[model samples]
Target chain A: MSSPDSSLAEQAKAGDLEAMNQLVAEHHAAITRLLWRFARSHADLEDLVQETFLRMVRGLPAWRPQQPFAHWLQRIATNTGRDYFRRNRIRDRWQAPLPSADDAATATQPEAVEPGGDPAARAAAEEVKHLLARLAPDDAALLTLHHLEGWSLVDIAAQYGWTVTATKLRAWRARRQLRALYLSVTPS
Target chain B: MNTPPDPGDSRWDDLLARARKDQPAPLDLAALQRSVSLEARRLASARRAEAPDWTALLPFRSLVSSCLAGTCAFTLIASWQVWQWWQVMPWAQWVVASSGGAP
Candidate 1:
């Protein structure tokens, strides 16, 4: 996987326009997922995804091929989203509570399907997203990647340049904090 | 494979699964690809724009840009004035008068 991504990245860096387009399409879904993990609303997701690719274009010239392309791309996407939140902090504060994910979960949910997309399932999804929104950005992202995406502590730590022990400790604390919040919100 | 959860354990896994199911809205791949292409062009143009213009031949890019801009402005103004002069007095009539023909 890294080999192909690396080759594609190399071509893109060398100004192969088709290869760049292919790379954009190839990584779009994963980047979209990563954006979804942090973003509260789905309204501006396409713009965010577009911004992610745009930043990738700007950063690809200075990219080192030693590290895997996906990792580098993910880092760039994370930074792009972080910058977006930073730029929009005041606007977001003035805006109404985000209703996209939660409302979407409720609205699109089908009746009589006990699968992962049923109403209860979406409600659970809504709860988790709401919980994530309540936490700090870093904590929210860590939990989303680890719990939702099953990224290992080592992998998460590697992305953040933290020791595995530190990652584990932080994840534990974050999970406890999440649990307390969840219990407070969800009545037994 | 369905892993059975112990009775006492919290069911966060199911919730995690549900969260994972709540995907972001589907994106238009064509639009993204188009944006990527557009960005490539934008970057190329920006690079070209940032490149020092050879005509200025000056070490400082700002001065070069300004000089080039001034040259263009002067050229445009000069061109417009010349056009106006030609409109007011035809060069052919001036040539006839200078050659001692009827003006």
Candidate 2:
């Protein structure tokens, strides 16, 4: 028997609006959670989630039933997150103030910290974002998926359509870069 | 030579752990649904706008083919006229006289 998601996907591809909406409703929270790490605020999170679903709907015709729907959605969400980072980098280059070494050192003290969380965790998260912002978008995404999301190299490779060996090399390099950045920004 | 410590090593776990603990705020499901619906509608309308209207081009279909055919015929006729003109030219006569019409 075909899975419910496969069935829903088939209907959605056939232009069933309800099926599309159902798929969105079912996966909205998961996509939001995945993209939250990439977002700077609640509004950005919402926008990313919306973009992910829009891409999903647009891509329904190309989705194969052999692949799990959730996995496909996850890939789309990851890609959406990567695109968000790329756009942010471009915007930061033009509009945002240039971050000085001192600012990098004190990045943990983000002004727009989300209210009502474990302050330490929030600060750490902010620090992580700052460090990630310093790296290339692709490297930051690779580190986020592998380190923060606890995804294995093989899984990340599969999602990114890269070979396991390549993924391993990239992950190693990204980790080393992050470590260097962290050391530079951290006070002795 | 000493190798630098890996960030994936145990020492960096504490920071990653703390980062993981920073959960996202609860999403407004209704707002998300509304946004998706609006985007979907916008995309549908955009796709509709992009779709080639063959029917609208129906009137021009014959016009375009006629224009193409007319241009081809004009080119062929012009080429034939030029060939005829070349055959009767003074240069043609000279070339024919020089080569004894073997050319």
Candidate 3:
């Protein structure tokens, strides 16, 4: 992810606004999705996304080429999202309504109808989202980065400044906890 | 005999596929570009104007402030202690000191 195009990076580092915009344009969608997944609501998501870019712009001059730029960017975004959640925890305390009977029914339905659209698959996604939503924000962020984002364990380790073993262990523990929670709440 | 499928593996694979497929439509890149460029200009201007002298001054400021605070606190305590000692000391000491220790 290190744009070995030294010219581009040099320009970006030198505060070339076009270069900076280009870099953001390349990864902004993924960053937005990642932040939205971590945030509790759209407004929080938007704020975190903006803050992430602000931090990136501020910290760009200090960035090292040895690091994968995308991973660093994601780490900043994750931390910014985490910080926003921490600061706004009280404000977000309005409990979301539990899944209704119909929602559960829809989830449990089989996916045999659409030859391409996997209903069971869709159900699993919905289940994962629901289960993740119930967990702590940090746990959800960790899970999304590792599991949903499909980042390698090493990449996650570097992103979070954790050892590979620690990342793996935490991911394992989070999955186990999530499984227990999912089963207890929505007995399959 | 039909082999039983691994439920956990199947579930996670399905979920991953869904996440990958569920990307929202791409944003308006032109609009993003415009806004990002505008922001970049504003930031660059601000950076030039402020030069972020605060970071350069931070350590010195912190050291001076801490030293001043500590000195003030110590001075207050010392002055209070001296005033207390003088208050408790006998009047004989004051009379002798008044005669420059001759009396």
Candidate 4:
């Protein structure tokens, strides 16, 4: 028996607009949560989520029902995040703002933090984002998956289509880079 | 200023733990669905616009069929003319006569 998702996917592939909408509705929240880790702001999160679903719709014809739909969507979401990091890397190089003395004070303001969230955790999240922003985009994505998301190296390698050995090497290098960046910015 | 913790210390782990605790607010699913639907429609329309229209080639296709028919008719007429010329040749008559008037 085919799964409901598989049936929906087949319908969507056959150009059933209702099935397409249903598929997006079912997966939208999960995609949003997955992309939230990569977005710097709510708007960026929305954009990433939209792009991921758009890509899913475009690639529906190529998706096989044998593969789980959720896993396929997650792969698309991860790739969307990676692409966001790459675009931001280029934009930041040319348009990054100069550091202001009041930046530290502003970073912790209530308006700047998530509502009903711990300030310390929010600060830590900001720090993680800062450090990740400095590394290569792909490295940032790999480390984000391995560390923040608690994904295994093997799982990440599979998601990225990299060999296990290559994933291990990359994880090591990204960790080293993060440590160095953390040390440099820390008060001595 | 507080001294930074060493990379090997528990502080790094603590930081990662705190960072992991951060969660995004619940998204507006209805809004997202609308946007995705809109974008999907736009992409579909774009793809349709870019696809080659076989119907648009109907005139050219008809022109090609006519050219092919004309070429076949010309070839048959030319072959018949060549056969008529060959029948009137002295060598053609000599061959028929040599073969017991089998022309």
- Fraction of the reference Cα-Cα interface contacts (below 8 Å) that each candidate reproduces: 0.57, 0.53, 0.22, 0.51
Listed in order, each prediction's TM-score against the native is 0.67, 0.77, 0.60, 0.81
lDDT of 3: 0.65
DockQ metric for all predictions:
0.24, 0.30, 0.12, 0.38
Native contact fraction (fnat) of model 3: 0.22
Model 2 alpha-carbon miss at residue A45, Å: 1.6
- Those runs of model 2 whose alpha carbons end farther than 4 Å from true positions after fitting are A96-98, A110-116, B1-4, B8-11, B43-52, B60-103
lDDT of 1 by residue, B5-33 (tens): 31113666667767677666568899888
Stretches off by above 4 angstroms in model 3 are A1-6, A33-48, A84-90, A94-126, B1-13, B51-103
RMSD of each: 13.7, 8.0, 10.7, 5.0
Better of 3 and 4 by TM-score: 4
TM-score of model 1's chain A: 0.75
Task: Write the residue-wise lDDT of candidate 1 on A15-127 in tens digits.
Answer: 88899998988899899988866665555567788888988998899998898888898987776665555545546567865444335435333334322234555566656
- Would you list the rank order by DockQ, best first? 4, 2, 1, 3
Write the residue-wise lDDT of candidate 4 on A1-188 in tens digits. Answer: 88899999988877777888899888887787678778877777878988898888889989998999889999999999999999999897889763333353344333453553667776777677767877899999998887678899899999999999888888787787787766666554
Report lDDT (Cα) of residue A61, candidate 4: 81
Whole-structure CA lDDT of model 1 = 0.72
lDDT of each: 0.72, 0.79, 0.65, 0.79
| Candidate 3 residue lDDT tens string, A1-188 | 44643445567778798788877787788788787555543445556677787788778878877777787787898788666655554444655555554465355443344222445444455556556665566666677666666667677677668887777777777777776655465445
Give per-residue lDDT, candidate 4, residue A86. Answer: 96
lDDT of model 2 at residue A129? Answer: 78
Give residue A112's lDDT in candidate 1 (0 to 100). Answer: 41
In model 1 chain A, the worst 10-residue window by lDDT is A108-117
